[model samples]
Target: MLRNRVRELRARHGYSQTALANRVDVTRQTIGFIEKGEFSPSITLSLKLAKELQISVDELFWLEEDLDE
Candidate 1:
């Protein structure tokens, strides 16, 4: 599964889901889904998220297990 520190980073940045969504030009539902691990962002969206969050994409996203390998 893909694991991310989106929620933690969002809190540290003092942003609500809607606020972050607006910054990333995505919907609040998209943020919620990503946070819940029910959805994964596309590369473009991921870059946008990383940029908005002031972090690297690698820092934001990772694999919880190397199951695919």
Candidate 2:
């Protein structure tokens, strides 16, 4: 499974789901799903999100097992 710190970073950047979604040209629900780990974004979308949140893609998303390392 893919895990992310999207919610935390979004909050730290003072952005609501709607706001972030707008910046990334996606829907608010998409942001919600991403935050909940119910969806995995495409590489293009991931790059856009990382750009908007001022972080790298690797910092934003990771594999579930990566946490065990």
Candidate 3:
């Protein structure tokens, strides 16, 4: 499973979903879904988000333990 630290990062940066999405070049709904763990972004989009949030891609997402296979 894909997990994201979007909510935490967003809170840390004091950014709303819409603002974050705008900075990341995605829709606000996409950011909402990402924060809720309801959607996994493509690599390119993930990179975009990481750049916008001023963090590394690894910091934004990780594989769940059970999915280690």
- The numbered model that scores best in TM-score is 2
List candidate 1 stretches off by more than 4 Å: 66-69
lDDT of 2 at 38: 92
TM-score of 1: 0.91
Model 3: residues with Cα > 4 Å off, grouped in runs: 66-69
Arrange candidates, best lDDT first. Answer: 2, 1, 3
lDDT (Cα, tens digit) per residue for candidate 2, span 1-69: 899999999999999999999999999999999999999999999999999999999999998764555
lDDT of 1 by residue, 23-55 (tens): 999999999999998898999999999998899
Candidate 3 per-residue C-alpha lDDT over 1-69 given as tens digits, one digit per residue, 9 for 90 to 100:
788899998999999999998887889999999988889899999999888888999988997865547
**Residue 23 CA displacement from its true place in model 3, Å:** 0.9
Error of 2 at 40 (Å): 0.3
Quote the positional error of residue 50 for candidate 2 in Å. 0.3
Candidate 2 RMSD computed on C-alpha atoms after optimal superposition onto the true structure: 3.0
Q: Against the correct fold, how does model 3 do in TM-score?
A: 0.88
Better of 2 and 3 by lDDT: 2
